[model samples]
Target: MTEPVAYSTVWHVVSIAIVFLLGLFFCVLIGRKIGIGFRFSVFLYLYHSFWCLVYFWYAGMHGSDAFAYYNQGLLGIDRIWFGSHAIVIVVSFLTSVFSLSYLGVFLFFNFLGAVGYLFFYSSLRCASIGSKKWVNYLIFSVLLLPSVSFWSSALGKDAISFLAVNLALWSALDFSRRMSLMYLAILLMLVVRPHMAGLLVMSLSVALFFDSRAGTLRKVFLGAVFTLGAVFLVPFALDYAGVKGGANIDSVMDFIDKRQSITKGESSVDISSMSFPVKLLSYAFRPMIFEATSVFGLAASFDNLILMFLFIYGICLGFWRKLNPEYGNIIFIVFYLFGAWAVLALTTTNLGIALRQKWMFSPFLIYLCLSYINQRQLGRLK
Candidate 1:
């Protein structure tokens, strides 16, 4: 006679199987709904799953905030909203309701991240409809970047934030029809990072106000709504982001100084003495091959190299001229991307933090660059 299988082990196995099935189902369903090919969606899901495992291994070897969240979930959470606490609440529900192990939770977040990739791909696919074959290849290359998958595949803020950002981007492609999704994205970002929600609101408000295509009445109505949202959210976001004294220059500078001082580590740099341009450059493209100290850093360095090449390519191709001021979504992306980029560059003193957080804005930058390239290609044909 054999001893009974441990309930914990059995539950872990069952939970993982369920999560995988659900992930596959949703991948196919969403792919069909979004008009992306089924095979490509499956490929994206599997690739993201592979990175999830990599993240799991890295976490086990080096430790991660994910384990803390999972342990807290096992103990249970009292709050269901706001910041990291919200993630803890989600973990609690998943573990308590489904009896999922840590690996299952990782896979679940991987599914969310995969959905984000699908949304991003769908948005780019729409933009690249008449683009050349090379444009498609470039877009595919961006989708396959390992850093985006690895950072977003874990049970942490990055996955949720990536989903929210991509959802917002997808909705922005057809803002009038998909305003609900924009709001949903804002709420998700608000729960995890209020400042980002504020930035989104503020950017959209400015874009709506300047949208030449909209009638004056429509512009006024939507602009007023989003402006009020920004008004309310910006103050709350400022507080949440540790700018206690408010949004004045002094307060902002103090906050930056505080961040630079507090975020000390092996990867930390003294950006306090750096010029604004240098800070932005460092935040977006550092950890170059020579600077990389670990396997992760080396991987990130390669991604940054691609981004650098894309930036130079965009400049050479005059992609900026391709942007139409008439398109409100273009304006919104520009505002949000640069706004987030500058803020993060100034505030994030640690290269490791910069690496994970850069995705918050980098996807938009990629979209803009790709859209411009696609437009250029179509123009050449015309």
Candidate 2:
């Protein structure tokens, strides 16, 4: 009986691989339809596939919450609306119906994620920055980042969130699109992470109201106001209402301080006492080469270094000064990145959690840098 079970598992894996290849082929075709050339699409499919494999191995070697999710799926659905329980039920149902091993489920969602990226890539065509040849390369680089691709290719809420967010962005940004897809994306986000869904809506609303092409002085004032209000006001409001188990402002700050203290021993930097800039840097660029204790950390550090360089380069290129809000994409990215960063920097105490949480916003970060270069070159031509 044990031998039969083992053979069944092996058969399941083999079949899943074949199905994944077929799915990837269809995704490549979709990519081709979206002007992503057959070769590039194939490359992306392969690249995303490779990382999905790595994510699976990493989840098994390291500790992952995927097993808990998987076990929850197996235990049957409870019609519960509380705290990711709905997602567990859906995942459980899918795995059960399809007879998916955890690895198979990982591959499947990663495939969905890859498809979502293609849709995201298509939506970029509507943005001012998407026409440049180098922008293509930069976007491809963002797609391959380990934090974006690897951590998001697993079998947990992160993978699902990544896909849902990408699809949502695509639907929201499409120039002449319908609302159905956007609504679906929002529903998925609500089921998985309602707070993030709210944040996304808030960011979009702010972006819609503040056009970037208005006066630079106006943009600066409004941007600063929005940033400060979001960073301080939302947390206080949530805490005051005791929403989502939130505590008062002091309690929240103390909680973050205590968390930093507790996790300082586990490859974490002590950032509790640091100023806001230092805390943000700790979130964005820590685990530097010298500080990395593992191979994964080293890889992450390299990406951090690249981001640092890009930030410096963008500043030198006057990217921040020349932000064009004529396009809706710029507005959305600006709001999303600032809002996400502000909240994360204030609340995140652990470096690892910081890294994972920030992956949701990395594409926009990369796009902001590339868009600066694109706009600068266009200005020269003008």
Candidate 3:
């Protein structure tokens, strides 16, 4: 009698192959749409997959949130359309319908992250057009950073949020024609994090209000729409973020205090005592190499070092002085970046959380800095 192969082993092997093939197909398709070379897209997909596997191994060793999400999905929770529950629903569908193993789920999320990388890379390519060699190098360095790929590759909110942010960013490059994409991106963000969606809408509204390139009638129409959106979204977002008392100064301060007090650990800091600038710095650029206590911290520190250098370089080059008010997209991104960063910095008291969450805004800062450098290079040539 022939020996029977284990069904679990067969399922695992088939799921892995399908996920890998599907990821490559999507990568190639998105690359073609974005006008990137196939080889580069494949390289990026492979690189991101490498980090996905790394995350899988790490999760197995550490018993991470990925396992929690997977286990919850196995319970067959009733599906919800938005919030963190949506991620569990996705896991449920994948496991119940597709019979994907845990490794398969990680690969699937890794593919989503790779798609996001395509959008991110396309946005930077648009912004860096005509930039000098060094600017391109810096942009590549940012893309190659492991922290982003690693955190976003597992079954969690981070992968979906990263995709939403990048999709929004790419749509902002040509906002009028890509308004549908922007709407989709905002919807996706709302599903994961309503507060981020609220911030994105607020930023777009402010940018449109000041956009010289937009017609007055268009501005008026959008202004009303955005006002309605804000009225609905802001309160919901505040409630979700644990600011139940509303947007008053006292409420916000209370929320911040609560956040600081609750998030205690080895990586926690006394953020309540820090000045506003220091708080921002700590959230965005702390855990420098000297302060790093673990291998992961050391890696993050190196990435931060690069980011710090870019910030200083942009300032030294007077990047802010070169901003043009007509580019409403730039204005939109700047407002989004600052607003998100400020809120997160105020609420995040743990370096580990900051490390994982800063990707939500740090990429915007990086794009802005690189765009400014590219513009400087173009000016010198002219």
RMSD of each: 3.7, 5.9, 3.9
- What lDDT does the true structure give each of the candidates? 0.84, 0.65, 0.82
How does model 2 fare in lDDT? 0.65
Candidate 2: residue pairs that collide: 212-325
- Expressed as tens digits, the lDDT of each residue in 13-107 for candidate 1 is 99898998899889889988878888988998888889998988888777789887888877897464778888899989998998888888888
Q: For residues 1-382, what per-residue lDDT tens digits would candidate 3 score against the true structure?
A: 1211213678788988899899999999999998889999999899989998888877766667777677777689656656678788888898899988878877888898888888888888987877788878888998998887888877888998898888888887778888888888888889888989999889888878987789999998997898789889988988887896788989988988888777646655556678999989888887899988878878999988988988888778775574543222888888999999998888877888888889898878877877777777777411
Q: After aligning candidate 3 to the native by TM-score, how far in Å is the CA of 298 from where it should be?
A: 1.0
TM-score of every model versus the real structure = 0.94, 0.79, 0.94
Which segments of model 3 are wrong by more than 4 Å? Answer: 1-7, 268-270, 324-328, 380-382
Clashes of each: 0, 1, 0
Off by over 4 Å in 1: 1-7, 268-270, 324-328, 380-382
Q: Compare the candidates by lDDT and give the number of the best one.
A: 1
- What is the Cα-based TM-score of model 1? 0.94
The model with the greater lDDT, 1 or 2, is 1
